[model samples]
Target: MLEIELLGVKMKNPTMLAAGVMGSTAASLNWVSCSGAGAVVTKSFSKMPNKGYKNPTTVEVTGGIINAIGLSSPGVETFKKELESINEEVPKIASIYGASPEEFSQVAGEIEQIVDLIELNISCPHAMSGCGAAIGQDPQLTFDVVEAVKKSVSVPILVKLTPNVTDLPEIALNAQKAGCDGLTLINSLGPGMKIDLETGRPILSNRFGGMSGPAIKPIAIRCVFETYAVADVPLIGVGGISNYHDVVEFLYAGASAVQIGTAIMNHGPEIFAQICQGLEKFMEEHGFQSVNEMVGLAHQF
Candidate 1:
């Protein structure tokens, strides 16, 4: 009942394992797929290896956890090895980032053959150098990167955007014009931080990082709802989804599919099955025959 075809890639259900959560290796990606996630996104990688921030990368906050892992990656060449090892039936998406359009294109081109989709992670709040939100926050940069990647790869591309932007719809429209097949909204929030009362210091080594959990859902929904109103490309909703109910809300807010991340920290890969089961039951009781039927329901009003 939850089957969805996103940018020509078919999925058994709408749930996807968001990038950055148990997505650093083939084993974990396979595990999430086995646990019932329809698709999985690998951790964001770059053309060159990045060690990212030091210890104390994540900390618990009032609403959710804040993390500044610095987008550490083992580089594209090494990540390709892990990607080739995934043995799951579900579609695999490679989440990539770079400091420039050429770099982004290079990474996407190399891995296009190994994955069904490429997610341009231009919204990581804590990315080091010039890689993350710096690209996403500018409409021109978003277009340049998306256009470059589109020219380099045949696989469908989704630009994961930052909610930290002031003109999100403008950025979303630019990506569409640049030929992105779809969009992933609201890649965490803040660059928020937590302070240790006893130590009188920041908990995370980076001082601040992106926030993810139940608290960011409303903003995520708003971003999706707003972006849907302006862009024609499909959207993959993310940020703080923990239950089937959250998935339904995203659909109604205009998401073609939903991705689960922070919730995985609390529920493990099993969250996929639990959410799928709950989604199926919810669909049955609500008379919704397919996930498509629920997309953008709120826009009508």
Candidate 2:
């Protein structure tokens, strides 16, 4: 009853594991699949391995977490082995990033045959200079990267967008015009930061990282809400989703599927089954027969 299809990929349920959280290896991705997530997105990797930031990469705040994991990755060659091992029953999405359109397309073309979908990581708030939000925030760069990847790979290309932009609709439209198959809204809310009360210094080594969890759900939903109106492709919502109610909200906000990241840190992979169960009950009680029927319902008014 909860089945959903995004960019021609079939998902048994609407829940997917957001990239960068237990997505670095086959074991962890498979574990999430076993735990009931409909699909799994690999941690964002690049052409070359990145050591990422030093210690204190992640810090906890009131409503969610601040992470500057720096998009640490093992590089595509090594990551492909892990991608190949993912269970076929679960849809595996490879999240990759690069500094230019050529680099992005190279990585996508290399791994497109191994994964069901390719998520371009142009929106990481904490990525190093010349990458991450720097590319996504610019319409021309965003268009170039999406167009290049689309040209290189036959598989679906999903451009993950940064919420830090002033006008998300413009960016969304650009991506759609560039031939992207889908969109993933709101990577993280900030170059947000925290402080050490005792040390009187910044908490994370990177000084600033993306803010996630419940604190960002409202904005994530708003991005999905607004982008859905402008984007020609399907939307995948990611932000502060923590419960079944949050999942329902994303669907109402126009997301074809919802991804869980920070919530996994607090709730564990088991959260998938719990959310699916709760969502099923809620749907039964609400008299909704399919997840697609509930999508974008909130925009009706």
Candidate 3:
């Protein structure tokens, strides 16, 4: 009952593995697939290798954990091998990042034929200085990146946006105008930090990082709702989703699908099957025959 189609790619359910969780390798992606995720997105990679932040890159906080993984990637050439190894039955999305539109286009062109979709990582709050939320926060750069990727690849392009922006709808609209096939709302919420009281030092090596987990769900839902009001393309919601109810909330908020990230850290891959089974039951109880029927239902009022 929860099958969905987005950016022309078919999903058996509206659940996908969000980038930067357990998405770095073929084995993990396949594991998520076997566990019942309809699709899996790779950890964000770049055209060139990035060493990322040093030790203590992640820290636990009250709501969720903070991470400044610095968009660490092995680069596209090496990442291609990992992509080719994923099971064909499960659609694979390669999440890639670059500093400029040309660089983004070049990377997208390289992997277009190998993956079902390409997620432009314009929203990583802890990414390197020139990349990440900095570029996505600007509508013009968001437009340029989307336009460049659209020009470079035949595969569907999804622009992941940051919620840290003052005007998210404006950026979403710009992406649509530039021809993005879909949108992924609210990549980790803050460049937030935790400090050690005794040492008077920041907990993370990078000093600050993006927050994820259940704490960000409300903001994610709001971003999805607001973007749905203005965007012409489908929306993929990712943030603090932990169960079937969270999935239903995202769908009700207008997400065509929802991506699971930090939750996997606590629940393991088994969470995928658990959530899918629960979602199927919920759909039956709610009298929804398909996921499409549930999309944007809350907005009807």
Candidate 4:
């Protein structure tokens, strides 16, 4: 009942392992697959190597944690080896980032044949200055990056968007116009920070980073609810998902599927199997026949 197919890629369930969680290597990606994620998105990699932020890259906050991992990637060339090593039957999505359209295309093209899909990481709040949210927050740049990647690879493209935007629909529509196959909404919430009272210094080495956890679920639901109304393509709901109820909320809010990130830090890869069990029970109790029945139900009322 939890099975889903997004943009021609089939998944056994709606829960995807969100990028930047335990997605950096073939070992971890395969681990999530074996653990039961419908699909796994690799940590965002760039065309060039990036060491990312220094020590203290993550700090716990009240509702969630703030992270400034800075999209540290070993670059596409090296990342290709990890992609090739993945042996799971479940779909694999490569999350890639770049400073410009050409760079985005270069990375996408390099990994196109290895992964099932490409998720454009134009939405990382803590990414390097010129990349990440910089491309996603603007309508034209989002278009340019998606368009460039679409031209470079035959694999479907899913553009991950930032909730930090002033108008989410504007960027969502722009990505659709650029021919992206689908969208991943709300990549974390804030470039939020925590300060140390003892030293009067910021906790994270990068000073601030995007926020993710239970606190951002409402905004993520809002983004999915709002974008589903205007977007023609499928929506992949992410951010702050911890349980099957949260998955139901995103599906009700109009997401065809959902991705889990920070929750994994506390729950471990076992969270995937746990959520699938909970989701299956929830579906049976609610009288839903399939995951598709729950999509966009909020818009009906």
Candidate 5:
């Protein structure tokens, strides 16, 4: 009941291990796949290695954690080692970021052999200059990046978008026009921040970072819902998914698949099976035969 095809890649289920969490190593990615996740996405990597931010890149917030990890990566060449190590039984996705179209295309080409799909990380709120949300915030820039990467790679491309935008549907339309195969809706929300009481200073080194967890799920759902109305490609929903019920909401919001990150941090890899099992029961009791049947069900009402 959970089987679904994404951009020609078949997955055992609709649940994926969201990038940036336990995605840095082949062992972790392999472990996640073994733990019941249908697929796994690596942490976003760049053409060249990046040290990212130093000490205290993450801090706990009310509904989630604010993170400014800066997309730390060992570069594509080095990341290939980890990619080669992933179990071939499960589909793998490589999340990549760059400052320009040339750079984005280069990285996508280099990693194309190692992953099933490439996800452009254009929506990181606290990325360094010239990268991340800066590119995604501009529709033209988003089109350029996606177009360049598409020209350079035969592999499917999924552009991860930012919720920190005025009109997300417009941006989604641009990506689809650029020939992108799929869309991953709503990267972390806000350059949200927190101040340390005793120190009288901002907690994160970057001062502000993306807000994630339960607080951003609503925004994610809205993004998926609106984009699905105009999008020609399948959508992947991500944000604050914590349980089977949350997964149901995302599917109802028009997500073909959903990625889990913070929930894994809060629980463990086992969350995949737990949610999948619960989802099976929900589907059976609801008289749904396939997960695809549940996609965008909310639109009926």
Candidate 6:
């Protein structure tokens, strides 16, 4: 009942393992797929290696954790091995980032054949100085990257947008205009931080980072809702999804599918199976004949 397809890639269900969580390696991604995830998206990698932030990369807050992982990656050449190793049953999506349209195209070229799709990671909140949200927040650059990648790879391209923008639909529309296959909403909420009460200092190594968990769900839902209103492409929702109910909410809010990240940090890979079971029951109970039937229901409200 929950089966759906994103950009021609078949998903057993609507649940996907969100990027940046248990997505860095073949083993972790395979575990998630084996646990029942419809698909797996690898952690965002770039053209070059990145060590990411320091020891205090993550710190918990009231609703979620603040992180400054710095988009650490093994670079495209090395990451190809891991992508090639992913199990056949799972549809693999390679999430990649770069400082420029040229770099993004280069990285996409390197891994396009190994994975099913390419998710443009121009929305990392704590990415290094030049190559992170800066690219996403700009309309022209977002188009350039999307257009460049579209030209470079035969694999479907999805542009992940940042919620930090004042005008998200504008960027979403621009991406579609550039010929992107689909969209992924809200990378993470904020560059929020948790301060050390005793030391009166920020806890994270980079001082602040994107917020994830229950706290960001509403914002993510809103992004998908607004984007779906004007976008010609489909959307993959991410942020703060912890339960089957959260997935339902995203579907109601117009997401074609949803991704779970922070929830995995707390629930482990088994959460995928548990949520799928719950989602199956939910669709039956609510008379949702198909996942497509549920998308954008909130607009009717």
**Candidate 1 displacement at residue 279 in angstroms:** 0.6
Candidate 5: clashing pairs of residues? none
Model 3: per-residue Cα lDDT over 174-277, one tens digit each: 99999999999879998899999999999999998999999999999999999998888999999999999999999999999989999999999889899999
Off by over 4 Å in 2: none
- Which of the two candidates, 1 or 2, achieves a greater lDDT against the reference? 1
lDDT of 6 by residue, 1-301 (tens): 7788888999999999999999999999999999999999999999999898887998888888888899999998889999989999899999999989999999999888788988999898888786656888999999999999899889999999999999999999999999999999989878898889999998888888999999988899999999989998889999999999999999888899888999888999999999999999988998888899988999986
Candidate 4 at 248: error in angstroms? 0.2
Least accurate 10 contiguous residues by lDDT in model 2: 125-134
Task: Write down the lDDT that model 1 would get.
Answer: 0.93
What TM-score, over all chains together, does every model reach? 0.99, 0.98, 0.98, 0.98, 0.99, 0.98
4 or 5, greater by lDDT: 5
Predict model 5's lDDT versus the native: 0.93
**lDDT value, residue 1 of candidate 6:** 76
Backbone clash pairs for candidate 4 read: none
Global fold similarity of model 5 (TM-score)? 0.99
Total backbone collisions for each predicted model: 0, 1, 0, 0, 0, 0
- What tens-digit string does per-residue lDDT give for candidate 1 at 186-252? 8989889888999999888999899999999999999999999999999999988999999999999
Better of 1 and 3 by lDDT: 1
Off by over 4 Å in 5: none
TM-score for candidate 6: 0.98
> Cα lDDT of all candidates, in order?
0.93, 0.91, 0.91, 0.92, 0.93, 0.90
Q: So what's the TM-score on candidate 4?
A: 0.98
Assess the local accuracy of residue 199 in candidate 5 as a C-alpha lDDT between 0 and 100.
91
